[model samples]
Target: MKSYLGLIPISAKVHRRQNRMTILCIVFAVFLVTAVFSMAELGVRIEADRLLEKHGSQELENLAGSTMAQTLYPIAAVLTLLILIAGVLMISGSINSTVAQRTKFFGMMRCIGMSRQQIIRFVRLEALNWCKTAVPAGVALGIMAAWLLCAVLRFLVGGQFSEIPVFGISITGIVIGSVTGIAAVLLAARAPAKRAARVSPVEAVSGNEKGTGALRHGAKLCLFRVETALGIHHAVSAKKNLILMTGSFALSIMMFLSFSVLVDFVGYLMPQYSDASDIDISGSGGADTVDSGLLDTLSGMEGVKRVYGRRTSFQVPVEISGAAEGFGAAESSGAADLISYDDFGLDCLKKDDMLKKGSDISKVYGDSGYVLATSDADSLLRIGDKVKIGAEELEIAGLLKYDPFSSDGLTHGEVTLIMSGETFIRLTGITGYSLISVQTTGNVTEEDVEAIRAAAGEDCVFSDRRDQNTSGTYRAFAACVYGFLFVITLVTVLNIVNGISMSVSARTKQYGTMRAVGMDGRQITKMIAAEAFTYALSGCAAGCAAGLFISKWLFDVLIAAHFAYAVWELPVNSLLVILLAVILAAVLAVWAPAGRIRKLSVTETIGEL
Candidate 1:
């Protein structure tokens, strides 16, 4: 008797076509894992080296000892876990299908006095034979992918990471990728291998495979044409297989939608600037740098919609009675920043959608009313409460959430009090505006921005919100998301193609019988197309539903808890993209396999059995 190890090469060579998809699955998983890890490790190392050079080795060591291990390790671990899960699912699906197709072959081996252990070994070794080629190819692909990703990040985004080193092929990444890839393959093969070992010779010869079941009992009952009914019957024949195919397809769609939603939601919740303005012109120097003359000049500019300015005060003494720390020019109150806006400034805030909650500043323009900008939990004073800043006493009018020009700095930190122009003038007796805010009309052109900048002068700073650094960050993140989307999409397409091909290949005899009787190639292609459509419809519907829940959960956990209003918008574009892709995949999957079977003669097809 041939040793199981020796039989593996023969088995793998003979059934190479059947194992092709499984091999590709392993290859893709390993490639992604290695490339991602390599990129991540390289980034960390580069950052660490830069920090060490700038801050000295001791401080760098401390950062590495504390932050690097604490944060980076946890993220790496979680990423590794997710990749492993994906790998296992892909490999297991292929292995399960492979074993189902080879039931008769397994049973014949059993009849030749092969032990259960020998069968298991044979299956595992056959998978390993594919890995020998796949692992090296996967590693090489990973290196190339990492290099490409780095180049894109550096040249395309052009921001903070523009100078950072983006690529390094880490030995650690290679080892982890290779090890996890093989581990996932082995674990996935175990169940199918064991099942193959248990198949009886009698059952195999009788054509009673593990996944097969009773044929369509009542063909006329199906609510479709004969060809369509047969296609549907073929899909539902093995309920487990249907579920597996649909589930895998659904997960791919779900991941794409959920990740896209996360990117959009995060951008909304954590804005780069106060608002999405076309142009933002702030004085580079002190408030004195931007005088009333410049403000008038900017307001009258052609593309400028409105111009506003704010008088800012820092570390002013305040007294909040009944406070735990007895706030007095402290970080909680007076030491915090204060912004007083005129009526025009108030209008600008409203136009930019920066107001969270409060009546118009017009209501408190000349009154003693004040708006407190602090977290609800950490608020020292409530609405209607009187507080004394220096000599002027003011009542808390309302609460303002995160705003761009606040003491809390964009999202959260220290508290600031906002008051009307008159109230601000009457209280601190200051009259100069510190920050000049500008809003331009729709899609400000480069000439408009240059004109503004020229008017502001070289000494005074100018910013076009359209060209903010946050845009670079957003693009980088979006690219990363789309990269993941691409990977999952490729995997999904492969799964569909492999699944359809395997199903059609297994039914060669049935197709031959139909062709011999009367059915044409067009009818055969239509039947396969119908089957693919059913699977795509079922999978996409289920996936969209799951994606919505995931997006909401991600918003709640990542965004809502951190900042303000985490609204869950429908991922309409993402849904449309997923639907279109699924449809295309279904068509390609069915068309390719059906075309092959259609060209074969009845005798040649039946002879395949």
Candidate 2:
């Protein structure tokens, strides 16, 4: 048993390519996990420090022990678990493919009286040996990555992020990465090691690891030539490999799309300055304070693109029949405040594409009766249903996902009913503008903004999206989220690389045989490409569908219900980028290996066979 240990080193050296790939997989996974954990931990620390500075150090002795730090711990835990799962699958698939290729070697060991236990031990030790070298290297890389990330964040956030660590390295992150990396390698190696131990001497010697696949009655033609068709068939014939490869590709796409949705979702739910306008002016007293004269002046101001105004009123009564189950709206009976928009105001809303349902306002100008503001409570109001307001019965023209005036006040628990200016006069019998929003042309300077502010007067309140109170904080959060997402996506790309590499390397002899039978280099490359195309197309399609479905549910649960904002739309740009990335990855995965095979002489390849 002691003597058999020598075989482990010998086997590793003999199959250095496979061993190198396995080590790379472990290294990349550990590196990413460590980097992400470190980043999250640093963020927690920085935030806690800020709190401590605000509340005093005696309030919380250690930043790590703070409430914010504790909250971050769970998020870190969940993210670590997800990364570990992906790492294990990636490492396991690489091992499985490599082991299958080395059946003959395993068989020889079995014939020489090496017990199955010895073989398993040998394989396990080899994996552990690789981890010994890879884990530390990965941890070091992770620390560097985390430091760089922190620096980038500091740069983007400027002096506002005074407490951000310049050289932060989390001890917990290193320990976690080492433990998870070692554990993942062991778990991933078990199946492949067992399979190797079970290989029979005869089967190994004869090089007959698998039986012939189910035969086709007739030759099936494909869009490509015979070589390409044969390659596609060969690729899909191995059900396990096909599924693994496709799944790897699909998960990469799915994660990218879903994370993109999450970013957009969070942005939408959070209170931010409107994208449609550079400056917003509101009446100091009430809805009637900002009049037509002020709006006209703002519209004609230098650098101003356009100006729009809305007449807003609070506590207008609208008849409600069946109140929603849990909205706590029974007290008000769904009698929301009324916000009336003029034609220009409606045009602004249309430009922003803020409507959640119903046709564009222009299409339903004269035909539509009223568009209701989105309600926090699940009110029993449907589009086209005639509901009685103060004095008139009007049809619910549409449902709005956004109303700027309502959102700012509604957080304190108020429901608003949005309508056109004509409807507001008919129902409330009052007509005066409350808020006047300003949109600037091209790039508006600080001087321009000041001029506009002066023109609006000191009494009027001006709000700029660029200078919003939470803009800096939001930028930091967005930067962290996007950086974390990029790391996860990179890990997935590594998985694809490993899966493709193993598949191609395992078929070395088969390729050689084809070469010997008169298949040229170009033909061989095309064959490999066809197989990649099949996998890429199938995987990308399935992943996109799954991602969209998940995004819908996520939007409903996390954003729509929580914020009472029902505008959930697909992140089309993100999905398109993902699709393009998958295609490019597939091409590179095939092209690289094919290029290597093309380098080897036909005789050399046949000799391995």
Candidate 3:
């Protein structure tokens, strides 16, 4: 009679508490998955256009005629394949955790003479019941969510909706949601099912089942059990179980963080670079023209940072320091990328105040008693040394270089010469100067520089270095890296949500016990939320540290090996966003599971326990 009484609660409890949470989780998962796929498709279309431009191909014109599906299908196919793999693992972990948490209940049913198969059958039926109820409701809600969100949230770039590759409820959506729901349940059941078959009836009746199989060992991972009574008990008793959940949550956090960094890279340039070399001047439409004079007028403009200038027109014949000719090709570039002449800006040396000898050092002093030698140049020639450039010989007083490659991993560059405009003219005998670099005080407006340039005449062009670094290459690369990362995070979060949902399912009896002990349903819910919140924040903390370290190392390596860049500075706001995203995703993942605790029943839970 008691056993029959227990059945009534089990049947009613799931619909009341568990069903709502499952529906919420599944619906959110579908929405994210769809978004990832659609966004990827949009990027592919953009990439296709870029490739056409790069290869000088007419494919874009032809591509324009193709329907949106042509572009979307490739992206969807690839993303769906990748997301499914991760989704499967996450669902499995979640389902397994649920099964593990509920092992004692199964064992007690067996103590009543139920066969292993009967236990499995009951559990499977229970999972099916949860699914049958949740999947339909989730799909319905997901359709509504997509409808509402799409209506309000515009795409990054505007496009025709019916024309754009967007997803709505369809046969495919139903299939995906159904499959995903079932898979999570099936995967979650494995461990619990295994335990039910092998665990002894006496152990099952006890409900602890310690020192059996996987659960018997490996419990030390939980730190400071004293902080939370429940956590301490769980650490000691369910070490293996906690490990699984920890791994799942940690992975989710990492993906969330790394992808966050990638998005920032695309949205903004590094500040020092953005702030310094604030404007590039294309010259010769008129000589110094109004453009050159326009620069002086820029200081008063709003958003004007300090502005500086660059001119690379003076070329002096330079002899190699080591060998007779010294000037030769670098092996990496087939020696093709070498610059034969340079016209450095006077302000370049002045801005840094790097001059060690002669004249306000605003400009290079050629053949002076003291020569400013670059580290690379110094290595080639020593102090009091002379490097023959053309017919003039310059004395090496000190070593100086604007080492952009210091952090880029590349060592100092080979070419070495610092000269004042007067000295350069004396040596090169070239009366003309070209190119202007406007280094602003970080807040200078580009428009202000252009206005200043009008005075310098048509000969000068004012722009940002980023604009000159060539357009769209950085954009594409960033998109690809971050797009892949977004997909990974989406999978990670899904797994987390699934795992948390299973956790709630596994602890239904425990929740009921809390209610039995006079704990409010809301209080029990809060505790579960606390646990989920703890797991997420911990993972985010760790992931953020790891991500920052990794990206910084990568930044250093790229500058040294490739770009010859000088310093690497972190984008603080960007990193903050990344960490914030990790926490946000964690909170979101916990919501579905937390809600389930509010439906606990004292009588039903005590029976299960």
Candidate 4:
């Protein structure tokens, strides 16, 4: 039972710059988790409410409960996990730097009979104290950020955000932020703690940084382990850095893992949506009530192939519980499905890759909410769920995920389904198609989409798959996420490389001593490299597992927020690619820094230390 006071010395040991970096990372992590989760959830909730509360709406309670009743836990999980990892690394980095400076102090402690356990306990306390000071503050600051966001959203949409918490004062938010922050801090502290406790009293008192001859030791040895004649020797190590080094490596791995998973997951799912065609067409209404017949007429008059329907709408209205009052209160909030008519149904046409998203609603709905959807609407809509229209609710059966790469509009993701004439009339009291898709009757070699547009007239809109731009939206978002992750990874790699470098620096005299006693620079380099390798390998494995779990959760948040959104179509190579890449990078990042170990002057280095 160590006194909390014990944390002071450890705290004193941490560098201010490193501390601030950790704090910033925590802040960003908190912001990312809270913002993404809350926005997606709150937005979908509002979309549902808007539909039902409007005149002629039905199925208010059942639809709302069923649709909005998914989990926010996954969102929380991803954010917490990521933030936790980052925090740990930052703490670990600080600890490693500190221990390098305080190496001798620890040696002195050991000489005085302070046990390794005691030193380890001291470092832990120091880490705990820092977490106590930093994490809570970050959580609080994250919470306060609501006002600013609310003001901004309100200004943009007039009244689409609530002034209050959408999920009850965000208590869960604060708790999560704090917990993750603390967890990260602790995780990063391991390496520094371990190394700081193992210093020898002799090394501590001598102050003469000299080369020592290494005798090998057995089975489980220290950081630098080798299977040699003297068994495996304990070439004196640092206690303070034990925690720091571990933490930094772990965090870096986490970053690598997170980014790789996200990319792989997204990459896996995007192609499933490919329509394989160069053009698709849609309109306001037509025969069979599925294709409006307009696209069929035009394409029949020209070149095209098989066309079909796609799920083009998944919209709902929700009274956002925790969002600000006006956060989702649209001046006129309602729902509609984007569809393509024909045996070539909207859903089928999507299979053909012929949609120019929102083109169906162009003339009638224009860019206005009355017909076209606003990017604002996308924040509130889902892709496969049902949206209420007047007295009827159109099931969003098939539609591309709402994203700007296609076009900015509510209709982008939410499609007003073109159902069986019987189903449509029975459900919506409407017996006409909202849109249609036309297939090229022949080779239909029109690569220029606009040329087909002339044939489509105002009756239909068309696009082809060659350069149809299906990957744009998905790639954009993925790029942003990966780019952000990349920056974090870069920082993490630098920290890791530096930590390893410092590790070698501190052990200069030890290396010199070893060389004097018969150990060569190559052997010493290998030893140091082994230490860095451990960190990299451990970091990567842990990071991959963590990143996958987090990415899955984030995907779920998208699903929960959007009633009918399909599960992301993950690719086969996703997991394999990510794992391999991260592990490779970790190895590479450490390689250069560790390689320099052999470059040190054996005699001079040993003598100077």
Writing each residue's lDDT as its tens digit, candidate 1 over 272-385 gives 443345655556766534665787888898788877777777756665544446354453455556777777656555665454455344455554556544434444555565
Evaluated against the true structure, the overall lDDT of model 2 is 0.70
> How big is the positional error of residue 211 in model 1, measured in Å on the Cα after superposition?
4.9
Runs in model 1 with CA error above 4 Å?
1-4, 39-82, 151-163, 198-211, 214-216, 219-222, 261-402, 407-474, 553-568, 603-609
Whose TM-score is greatest here? Answer: 2
- lDDT string, candidate 4, 126-161, tens digits: 766666556666655555454344444444223334
Q: Which sections of candidate 4 miss by over 4 Å?
A: 1-70, 78-82, 89-97, 107-175, 186-203, 206-484, 487-499, 502-506, 514-534, 538-588, 591-604
User: Clashing residue pairs, candidate 2?
Assistant: 370-397
Worst 10 residues of 3 by lDDT: 332-341
TM-score sort, best first: 2, 1, 3, 4
List, residue by residue over 382-422, the lDDT tens digit for candidate 2: 45655567666665555555445554323334556667777
Error of 3 at 446 (Å): 14
All candidates: TM-score: 0.68, 0.74, 0.51, 0.49
Candidates ranked by lDDT: 2, 1, 4, 3
* Error in Å for residue 43 of model 3: 1.9
Cα lDDT tens digits for candidate 3, 1-609: 455335634654844543444344444444444544434445445556555657657666666445444534543453344334334345445545544665566677778888877666665566556666656665665455444434432343233222333344445555665676566556655655565566557767656554433544432435533224453344235555565566555545444443444444443333123324545565645432233345456556555555443223323335544333333443211111111112233444545444333334422343342334444322343455556664655555544434332453232445444455445545555434354445444455667556655544554555556334322334434555565565455555555556666666666565667678787645555556656666666556655576566556544433333334344455566556545655666567556655666655556767766
* Winning candidate number (lDDT): 2
